[model samples]
Target: MQVLFITGQNQYGVVSHFLDGMREDLESVGVRTDSLSVESEQHIHRDLPQLLPLQEYDQLISFNGMGLHLEQAELSVPQYLKQRPVWVFCVDHPMHILKRIIGLNVILLCVDEEHVSFAQLCGFNARLFPHAIGKQQLANTSMMPLEDKSNEVVFPVSYMDSGSHRQALTPYWSQIGHWVEQSRSVTRFMQFIGVLPIGNRPASLTLNEQILRLCVTVDSYLRAKQREACLHFFAQQNVNLTVIGRNSHCYQSIAPTHQYLNAMDFTDLQQKIAAARYVVHNSPGFERGLHERVIYPLALGTLVLTFETPYVNQTFPQVCLDAKQSSGQISDKEYQQRRKQAHQQIEQQHCWHHQLRKLFTSPTTSPDSNGRTR
Candidate 1:
């Protein structure tokens, strides 16, 4: 089989690493694959269809429905690819996914179950296919030694918004944003509302319900505060920590004890995670998806210390924390065990090769009238 892989450019170039890994995995399985990287929506609208002839490939795999205007635009790519199957690997919010390709003849592969349900609600074909560790890192047959690791702790996070970004959003939600950020009770309440299971919920919602739904859809304020809270907590501890990402200026001010690093490609970041004694991730306030940060480190045999959530706690019960704790709270023995179990879990269920195999072979690909694929 032949495949066309699409990914976008990010500031850190992490998406490139993921695309490279996917291409390698497909080739290993005897599939002819090619990749395209786009920087903006104009790049996708103008350049994607022309990247290759649709008849030359049997499948198209798009990473993150970024830069797509399928619903509104009269596009050639979507029309041409309708003759074949198109699979999207989306990590963004559910609403963004729904907005981009609701009416297209595409198979939606979502990173989170909530996204799958929300897409189904909008009458689009969707399935829950979570993100997995890339083939490059997973190819390592042996785990690295603990002593060889350089950093004691490593974390990669981006500040939710900059000053100008806040100014742009403030006009619409200044008061509501303040309430959600300042009040812990309000944030928790909103988070609970945000975590409501998507499939069985009422079809028609009241105005208040719609507002809460909007919170789930657009959760930048809560994410920013959550990252701030995690940084503050880490700063309070005496552990040696290294943070890498854009918007370090915002976090560096609060976490004086932690060492800040510059934005980098995922290849180097994965190396850091493998070498670190512990990979730290604090839960984002209202976000329900398992981010690449969490999955990558686990695949590399790093112990992750993050807050307890239904998704994390239920899916990987061995890795969840009892309370909001820093790296110092964990012991050496505990770290060893968690790291071992994390690696085992990744190899068993969360590898990219396994997900791809399922994508092609699973009979659970049929979409219902309501857009659900059971």
Candidate 2:
């Protein structure tokens, strides 16, 4: 099989790393792969035609719908893309890219189960494709003894302050809060937003579209709040905390006592994880999915302290530390056992090769179905 990856610029430059890893893994399995780098929307119109006048590959894969948004006037581009199956691997919430992907003949491979449900609700074909640890990440990491690790806690995430989002979204907070309280899950919140009349809907968007946009905004705000809360909780305990990512200065106000460093590429981030005693993962919106952040640290022999989510509790109950609980209570022997179990599980089930096999072999689901593969 042959696959063409639609690559593009991302803020943190992690997407390129992911594509490179996937390419290596796919080739190892006898799948030929190519990539097209799109710098902007204009590049898509200009460069995509190069693939036209002939069918070249079995599949066209993109992350977060990067190069698939073809304009209606660009008949050739859309026609060319439609000839081959298009797959979008959504690493974040699907709602954020709903507008860009509306008319494309693309199947969504979501990292989270809730994301699949959200995409299906929006009338798209989606499947549950959980995040996995790349082979390169594993190859670069060496398990450090817990006592020998340098940092006590490391959080490698891009920071977004919730206060700004909260103030901007204040007008719709009461209604959004009410909907959130009634419907605890993101999928259900979207259902309510679709049917209920939102008086504060934006003038530019249709009712459903406007409400859905609000839901995305609200989700972002909540996620930011949750991250901030987690950071503050750790700082209050006076643990040796280190924050690494963009907007490191934001930590000054949020948690001044903690050490902060600007963002680095995925390669450097792996080094940081391999040295840390514990990695804190704050996944606020992903209730039924595991983030690569959670998996990478565990695979690197660093215990993960994250919020209690259904997927984490069920999959890595031995390794995950509930953000609400004290990590100091766990004995050294227990920690070693948990780390061993977590590493084995990731090696056995959550590696890139495992995901690639599932991606190629699994049957696609109907758009009307429940959007789950496992």
Candidate 3:
């Protein structure tokens, strides 16, 4: 069946953009798909309220930022779905999903057992579709070593609101960050390896970070007498952090363990993230559930260092750490073990082969089955 990814990549579509790239992975496995970005094509604007690009899609996969106006706006989610069976994918906060569910046919979820308990309280069909790191680099472990890398660490920045980001991990950021700080020395990372940076500001209210800079200078200002101590420690250690994706956010003042590299396309971002020593991710917000940013790190076979989130615990339990307190800890051996486990799990459960298997084996597509959408 043909699937249409009806989405917006502008002002309101920041987080929504996370789920759109799955189309590439899906297509690699034989799924016919088209991604309709609200901010890209001129026709989308000319179509005026009628965003339907190519004709008849067997299914329309709606991301967040879709339906609140999903059904109301011009060339919006709701308008496109009315013509066919639309599955409202909800990996975001329950409140948003609940709002979109008002007239949607189905509420698709990327939930885990831990979160499902919470989902029950919100009263939506929060199911566990799980997320894959899009299969592109599931086995690309041949990464290059850095030169004179003082710190063998990687901290990719997120565009999430600084306040919401810290709040989500208030339960565990320091503890996790600290352990990561202590986990490696000069030998392990040899040099810090940061990954893709997005445009700070797009030409429009879009995802291009072409014009953004780090809030405080990324240099000494990044580590003052009383900021997150873990970050300060890295700076103090003279770490060599290589910023990727090349956003204008000049952390240049921070004297990051290293220099920023040239920009990369999204696919290269996946490859580089997979090659890094480790990636540090903040947890999802209270209202927003698991975000897809976390998975790419895991898929890359890079050990993940982030505030623990329920989704990660359920999917790649062995390949990560959940640092719950400012000073809590987990072992280097444990970290290593979990990292290996994450790699194995991705190969088994998260590869594109598995994705294709699920599609063909699902109720309607199964050989012995009657036609029905799961």
Best by TM-score: 2
Model 2 C-alpha lDDT per residue in residues 94-149, reported as the tens digit of each score: 88777768877778989888788767756787888888876765666678887887
lDDT of model 1 at position 82: 53
- 2 or 3: which has the higher TM-score? 2
Name model 1 segments beyond 4 Å from true. Answer: 40-52, 66-76, 97-99, 162-218, 237-240, 283-288, 308-310, 319-334, 366-374
**How much does candidate 1 score in TM-score?**
0.77
lDDT string for model 3 (193-297, tens) is 121111342122211222111111111122221123333444565544455534413544444444556555556665566566655554323212344456666
lDDT of model number 3: 0.45
* Model 2 weakest lDDT span, ten residues long: 365-374
Q: After TM-score superposition, what is the CA distance of residue 276 in candidate 3 from its true location, in Å?
A: 3.8
Per-model TM values vs. the true structure: 0.77, 0.83, 0.54
Superposed by TM-score, candidate 2 places the C-alpha of residue 168 at a distance from the truth, in angstroms, of 1.7
